[model samples]
Every structure is written in C-alpha cells, then in structure tokens.
Target: MAATGTARTAVDSVMAQLSALEDPKMRAVNERHGDDYGVNLSRLRAVAKELKTQHTLSVQLWQSGDTAARLLALLICRPKSFEQDELDAMLRESRSPKVQDWLVNYVVKKSPHAEELRLRWLSDPDPVAASAGWALTSERVSKSPEGVDLSELLDAIEVDMRDAPDRLQWAMNTCLAQIGIAHPEFRNRAIGIGERLEVLKDYPTPPNCTSPYAPIWIAEIVRRQAGE
Candidate 1:
C-alpha cells in the first residue's frame, strides 16, 4: 500500500497479472529473479530498470506454490531502505521460516539495526529462530569486529537446547566446536560445552557420518578442547 507512487499503476497491473498466472514452474523461476526476472538475462535488466521501486506489485507473483518464487523473493527483498515496521511486516508475510531467518541473518550482518533484529529473533517463538540464533552467535563470535562473549551466547543457546530439532542441535554444537578451535580466547568455553555433549561417543549424522554429526561433532570438540 505504501509503495512508491510514480510506478503505482504499472506495478499494480504487473502484480495483478503475475498473481493470476497458474504456471508453477515459471512463477517459481521468475520469483527468484525478482526485478531481474525475465526469459532472457537482458530482460531482467530491462525489467529492473522499468521497476525502480523496492516494493512492487509483481512480487505478489511469489504467492504461488513455486519454491523458486519464494526463494527469489527472499533473495531480492532488502531491509536497508526499509523502516522497522516494514521489515517486520515483510518477515511476517514471508510464511517461510527459513526465509525469515535468512532475512534476519542477512540484516544482522550489514545493517546498523542488527541488534534490534537479533533481540527480536532471539525471543521469537519459532525453533528456526532459536537455531538461527545459535548460527548467528557463531558468526558474530567468529567474525564480529566488536567480538562477542561466547559465555553469554552459549548460556542463551543452552536454555532451549533440549527442544531444538536434531539437525539444528547438531549444527549448533558443531558451530560451537568450530569457534572453540578457531578462537583460543573461547577455547575453554567451547571445550566445556562440546565435551559435555559427548558428540564423538555417538555415531555421526547420516550423510556426514554413519548416523549424524552428533557423535563425531561432540567427540571432536571434546578432544580438541582437552588438547588431545
């Protein structure tokens, strides 16, 4: 509704047409491209040039069941120029929790408003949010210029560790071990958590291991932490 005015009519028309399309595959593919979406790569540039505003009617074309469309929307959606309310609105409508986490994770890295998004996400009811929180914590501790306190993040993560999905738990613990080995400052902290998880005692997660990353993930962390 608050979309830019100059392109209103054209965008509305496009939104209407795209929304009506029933072809799942084309919608999915086009959604990924966003403004750049076109049968030809050149058409993307032309379309983007024609549609200068951030929010457009054509984006609704993403409502189809096409996974590509949903993914593309996430790829093209930008929070830099968006107001806080707008960002919140976009996350709410996204429907895809992964995309929401992707948006949150993306903004936290580049936007000055990272803290706001982080706090909101940390408190989110979604398990993906908690899992994303762990991932974000790992990234911040590993890469943040300001340097994060691992103890604080670990404490928060451990709060709901029992409830996270197995895959998320595996990733969360694996990330912790990686940080421990890479950041000596947090080595003790990482080792403490990793050893306690006893990841190596169990089988590795399937694909990555005989079973899951849990076994080896936990074991490796404990071993490295103990200086073995």
Candidate 2:
C-alpha cells in the first residue's frame, strides 16, 4: 500500500524535527557505524511518540532513506504487515550493524512469522539473513526454549561457527551463551563448546561490564541464577 497524503505530511514533520535536533558529533558517531544522519534515538523516539503513528508514517520515513528515519521506521513498522521478502530487503538495505541489530530485535522478532522466518533464514546463504536468523534464534532460546532443539543448535555451532561470517559468528556465540544460560540440560555442553571455540575470550571488556566471551558470560549468568 502506498503512503497517503497525511502520511507524507507526518513524514515531513518528522524530518523537520530530526533536522532541528541534528548533532554533528552524533552524526559522526553514527557515520562510524554506517549511519549518515545525526538524530539520536531518544530524540527520534520522542518524535515518534509525539506523532503517534506507527506503520503509515514508518513506511513514508523508510522511503525517505534518512538513517535516523529508517531506524525510527523499524521502531514503528507493523511486523505483521511486513512479508518475508520485505524483511529480507530491509536486512539487505541495512548498511550498519546497529540497524541490522535493531531490525532483528525490534521488528523481526516481533513479527507473527518470526519463528518461520528464523528457521528459513538460519541456513540461508546470505550472511545478513543467516546472522538475523541466529539472532532471532538466540532471542527464542532466551524467551522460550521448550520447542527448540538444543542439541541441534549446539551441533551447528560446533561445526560452522569458526568459519561463519563475522556477524553470524557473533550471533552464533550469543546463541551459545543463551543456550547455556537458559537451558539447564545443555549448560555444561554449551560452556564446553564456548571454551573450545574461545570466541570473544580476549575481546577486552571494561570494569563492571560482563564480557561477551561465552564461557565467562555463561558462567556468570549461571552462577547468578544459582545464587552463588
């Protein structure tokens, strides 16, 4: 469906708000991450909240191709309204890791077809789709592991993680950590896999920050859960 006149007007207003709030420093930071626009999340969200329109305005804003506008579009887009092809297009168009992460976390995971897409994309040749699939799988593992085959996921991580694409490798590592934390049946095996893979083990985490190193992250969460 095409955006209506009202949607166009809302898009214009949002663009104006974004322009008014532009920060060169923030833009530079965003550019470093593949975004070209300067609007911050807080400001964009405030504008979205003020507009009180989600899908229609989101469609228009996404078409505008402003980095912040596209991010906001992800925030407001109706997940159910988007087809798998459209979601794939969005992933392909996402130039930065942040946008891709937001698309997975905010829009794709919320879709009614999330599980279907997750499974379909898991083995997809496209790196972005595969990475998103793993990310979605990780979210599922965290929220609801009852139906997931923990053994199968572990096998895939063990076999393919080392050679996977960069983003997919990150997601696979996260999936390993999530499996360890969320599924007691596979906790030991997950930790073992993490220790063997040694993924992100030397990534240098700051003080008081939990390392993304699967072994450490899993151990900490498991320890916390056990009240140790």
Candidate 3:
C-alpha cells in the first residue's frame, strides 16, 4: 500500500497548489507589476508550460475570456524572454491596457526590434502603441547620426494631440520633453508644445507627462536654439 499512499500524497499536493491561486485583487496588482517579475520567472514558466498542455489556465489568462487574467498571464509571461515570433504573437493578440503599457514602455528603452517598433509607432491603432512608437523614434534620433528629425516627429505629435487618446498624447508630450531637446530642428515644435502645457494640467494627464522641471528645460532649449 506504500505506492498507493505516495500517489495520494502527490495528488493532494497538486490539489493544494491549484487551491492556492490568487484572488482577483492580488491578481490585478500582479498584472500591474508583471514585468517586474524578475524572480518568479521559473515558476511562471512552469505554470505557463503546464497550461499549454492543460489549456484551461492559459486560455483564461491570455484569451478574451478574462482580461485581467489575460493581462496577468502576459505580464507574467513577458519576463521569461521568448523568441521574436512569440513576442510578435503576444503583441498581435494582446489588447489589455496594462499589456499595452508594458509593450510600449519596453520599446522606448530597448532596441531588439528597431524597424518593427518604428512601423508600429507609425500605424498601431492603440494610442499607447503610437506614443511608444514616437518615443522609440525619438530615442533612435537622439543617438543616430540622423540627429532626431523634429518636423516629422512633431507632425506625428500634432496628429496624436488631435486624434489620439489622452494617455498617448501625454506620453508623446513627456517623451518630447526628454528626448526632443538634443536636435535644433525640433526647437520651434518643442516651444509650441511647451506653450500648451497649461491646457494639459488636468487630472487625466498621463504620469510623467509634465516634468517638474519642464519650465527650466523649455527655457534652456529656447535659449540654446536662439544662440543666447
């Protein structure tokens, strides 16, 4: 009966693990900070691996069946480092705002898929995606010998300001403050957007849109551009 007892113990362990799934609130926070899951990668990968077989949990988390769960799953899955094709699938499939935030934020700082990012910035339906696209463009311009063309980027910003979501508009404006200053071509555009800072002071402003030191930066840019 020792073999039978071992089987029961293993079954019980699996059942207990299943029972430990987090409640909704905890899961939401986990989804929010999913990219920060630096330590939980192995466990998350194991769970994701099992879901590919079982198909229940992965379906609930990644598909339209449950947005929060889907978001958490992507957030959890994101840190494990997948192939470019896998990442493309996730980007194509994911529609969660949280996931969008993570993906766009990733593009701003990383360079693995440079051309793809530029394309997405130009054409993505989601404002966050577009905002991230421009932010990534600004980053490329800042570093590349192309020297960060202001006219096109500013025109894109103007389009976003008029037609895109406020979140994306705010993100574009914020990135403008930080990244657009290096090039002289964007000086007039920078001042023009900076002039509108007063209109964007309302509550719905995206985080980091208005730098605490933006006025100082604007003055500096204006002075430098004018040869003062």
lDDT digits (tens) for residues 10-48 of candidate 1:
545554543454356654665664422223323333444
Q: Write down the TM-score of every candidate.
A: 0.56, 0.91, 0.52
RMSD of each: 7.4, 2.2, 8.6
Residue 70 in candidate 3, Cα distance off native in Å: 6.4
Prediction 1 TM-score vs. true = 0.56
Off by over 4 Å in 1: 1-67, 92-98, 105-108, 145-147, 166-171, 198-228
What local lDDT does model 2 show for residue 7? 66
Query: lDDT by residue for model 2 over 62-162, one digit each (tens)?
Result: 88877778878887778789888888888888776777888888888888878888998899998888999999899889998768888999999999997
Model 3 Cα lDDT, one tens digit per residue, 63-116: 433444444354334332444454555556555555666554543244366556
- The local lDDT score (0 to 100) that residue 45 gets in candidate 2 is 83
Question: What is the TM-score (0 to 1) of candidate 2?
Answer: 0.91
Ranking by TM-score: 2, 1, 3
State which candidate has the highest TM-score: 2
